[model samples]
Target: MAAHRARRWSLGGFVLLVSTAVVAAFAFLTTGPSADRADAATTALTWSDEFNGPAGSAPDPGKWTLESGGSGNGNHELQYYRDSRDNAALDGDGNLVITARKNTDTGLRCWYGPCQYTSARLNTARTFTQAYGHFEARVKVPRGQGMWPAFWMLGDDLGTAGWPSSGEIDIMENVGYEPGVVHGTVHGPGYSGGGGIGASYTLPGGAAFADGFHVFAVDWSPEKITWSVDGATYQTRTPADLGGKKWVYDHPFFLILNLAVGGDWPGSPNAGTAFPQTMTIDYVRVSASGGSSGNGGATRTGAVKGIGGMCVDVAGASTADRTPIQLHDCTGVDAQKWTLGGDGTVRALGKCLDVRGASTTDGTPVQLYTCNGTKAQQWAYTSARDLTNIGADKCLDTKGGSSADGTPLQIRTCTGAAHQKWTLA
Candidate 1:
């Protein structure tokens, strides 16, 4: 898929540049942290649009803003986006249909002079913005040589931060040529345009996505963002994957849905490409962490006991940064008292449980670091009893899986081993 581009218009019609291109493919992974924790964690509905309005009605004005223009959207796209029902409307069947049609009689001018196509773009920029949660949509994508449909998001601070600095997250994007595959990507300062980090999810048996509706979603947290198709995870991007580039996704972002007829990425529609292609959206929903008030929902203060009932200890009761965390006899001491904060940090002695150097390599020692708001300090306690480092996607384990006192703790691939299990008590 081509890099997804973003466009923001001002009174003077000036457009800010925001583009995305997938530079690397992430390895496919299993379900995210919350996927298996239904009995332990819950998600509360934050916002939703079922598209259940009367036939031919516009989208709920209170929820979506129709973006109409023809400035090429910074990607040299050919469609003249319009606010008319001819381009977007409800089918009276609980679906929002966004249609792209060949129309030269509208007298609308595009970046390439006379506009040859018309389409619709909708966004929630003025209505809703969320920081960390689950965002999802069910949709049936359009098909043809130049069809490019997407469900994505942009940082809420776009007006001030501008383009790449504001950040972008593409939950789903599909080009006509790749019928069986869809992509998810993230764009930031050094990774914008063709340098975005992303990955693809292909349907089994080469089934075309246009044939039916598929669910696209992302579970976002302070340190990680996981993408899924039909409830199956395809990729997870963390600060560790950004090569030291700034991780600017720590704030709120809004949503966008659009179908373009042609663009610099997908090229123009071919002679065989028929007109009036439609992308059908069944619903769009957002949910917040259910059990608590902050990011990960659960906040508890106590000792995090691990293998053989040993507590996770801050070495030598130190409050200094870089203090090694170890598995030691449970003493209920301050150094062994860990607070799993709602903001995703596991804190003790005024510091956080951190993966030293933010390293993703196996055996990287876990330590007590002064909280820096980086992924290294972000941790998620799962229902499986694993303390997962969001950046490394690994679990806290006793070195050598030993239960001996003073055994150092480190991050290792999550294996559900006895040594990786912990009890917040």
Candidate 2:
């Protein structure tokens, strides 16, 4: 057999430079204080598959397709890939389980030798591929010697350009020998196989990854790619980290999930290894950086312009707890940036606009508090320009109906007063 090359990929050779017009257009649409802040504080759910079907059901064909064969996959793997439900099926508990089982049947064939195991590899290459955005998956990986499970992406031009040139983003890759560690890597020309640019993150407290489901995600853009496990970011790769090599992850890529029995990196499973190892996947989601289409009930974040054209600001631009939230000059500062969340909360400085102590009486001061999902933090920025606090049943008011720059904000009965009227910029 030929040397089984470790599967890897690269970004394309062509460079598509960003134009000034395109940057200006993106800046105008996205909600950010400055034009260079392309990664604004908004995301539109573009695609997702929850795999929430009944027990023994196959994955939705509309969203995924199985890649079957015993071609060794350039890794001299031991498993014979198959498109059968026996290898991949949904467990009643809202998960897609891809199982690698010991194949004991006689006369079974594989590229290297007798087919000793069977497994499944699934991809969304045809159904969905995206360029820049956030891609995430929740998975509980199986454990044992030689157990290799991965959640990764490949450049859309794989058919023509092929590996090492099509660009590959390995969001999550686990080799059972290192049960507590997982890797995130990128492959491209001159950086394929053992030469890929990447990093690894170990679970805290020396915990095995099989202990529970964990989220693996990546924030991909033209400038960089950030990998995180759960909510903690571990590594970020940028053009400067490429060691003067060409950066190739500027185009669209498709998602792939697979569990392999034995591969070059993990070696072959031994007698101590367990049979029927399974990897459970909860869901895969992709989000894009763009303006809301108003179709998914997505929230809008921007400056809340009020009377006298001043902005609803966080006092002293502070993130400190119990910071006074008042009206100030509209300067497009972070303190003035507010997101009218779908959950009915006006959030800024990573906290919610809250009525002090959830008070119901008039003239109670408004403050920025840690978001607790309480009713006091809930608000409705209506078309009539009133920011009403639901728990207090009062409108956000400027104290004494003052339009001064340093006036404090409070909650009062909804009386349609000029102080209660506000506009979102």
Candidate 3:
């Protein structure tokens, strides 16, 4: 796929690193509000690694490829990137250290033959690819004036379809100057990037990214791409923006880890810039389970209108009671202001449309008021094609248990119930 061009402000000098603070890493996600067929037990997790043994023979041919060139692919920094062992090394310590050393190779032309430094660009392009799945990586970067390290994934169909056409998701990108701040960006049609191409997320503590490794992840699906660090989700985007350009991301993609030196990103290296800057990759993984498709659990898709019954951007809301509430129109009202969430339970008013305070006794009206902090609001759907409210031990029931609207949705005990259980219907 073609690389997307956007206005990128050299933030290497702008973002100041935090010098004092406690490091607290945590992910905010619900574990067991209820049980579903797709519970942790039924799912499986898969894994893979570069595993170059001890010699570090230039990223495995089965797992990765070296992207070559020094033509300043837009970001106008200086170092020529090479695919040699000196730059990309794998030691017995179980780490892939891609270094950007101030050396130079002369075999090639380009007049100024061997310059000052070379970096490595590697990717898992040929072996296998994936789409709409979970991806995560743990890495530690190097610090200095010109060092720029990125842990990201790109669409493989780029050569045929250009950028802004084939989507790009940047999980973590850090510059030496801005040590503690990390960037999470998305590139596509309208959400086109460049002038500061993406966004920046800073840690409370001024922990230089070059000092320690951090876990970066992406929960991607057919609907959107969410970028998180240590479990804190920071960015998300929908299909409408890129689908118009031909939803290239709907297909599979691979992983890439590169420690670039002097690109258009971090500006040219300064005299103070350190030599042999390195980026260490602990591991890269992809998971096929534990996710949310943004389908509002009901799978009821006709025309998404309001928030609560009110606000405009359900895209920005996230909380227990505050979630996208399928509403009627755009009148300025609290009920209209819907907050969308990663968790499946969809809410509008303060509370969840739970089985009436978790009362399994039949005819529990699905009400929305305020959050009562009880199990009644907990809901779960299973792969067994069933839906249940764990607290009350009941299933969502349709009035007369019919599939018609205004059937007055409620909750009833499960008894091999069909209408009572659902799968996004």
What is the TM-score of each predicted model, taking all chains together? 0.63, 0.62, 0.57
Residue 333: error of model 2 in Å? Answer: 39
lDDT of 3 by residue, 165-230 (tens): 556777888876788888877765555555213457777777777778888888877777787888
Off by over 4 Å in 2: 1-5, 8-41, 291-425
Give the lDDT of residue 330 in candidate 2: 86
Per-residue CA lDDT of candidate 1, range 1-425, in tens?
Answer: 23554432321122321221111111111122444333325564445788997999998765677777787877788888888899899999999999999885667988789999999988866545667878999999998898999999888667668777888899998988888999999998988877888999999998999999999999998899999999999999999999999999988787889998777677789998988999999999876554522233533556889889888998899766688999889988768876564556676654568899999999999998755568887777766888899999999988998999899999999999999999877
Candidate 2, which ten residues in sequence have the lowest lDDT sum?
A: 17-26
Off by over 4 Å in 1: 1-41, 291-425
Cα lDDT tens digits for candidate 2, 1-425: 01123773211111111110011000112222332122334685545778888999998775677776665676777887678899999998889999999997656677777898999888766445666778999999999999989899877667667676878899999988889998999988888777888888999899999889999999987799999999899999999988998898877777889998887888899988998999999999876655444322344567887778888999898766789988898888768878665456676644578999999999999998765558898787665778889898899999988888989999999999888998767
TM-score of decoy 1:
0.63
If both were scored by lDDT, which would come out higher, candidate 1 or candidate 2?
1
The candidate that achieves the highest TM-score relative to the unseen native structure? 1
- Which predicted model would earn the best lDDT? 1
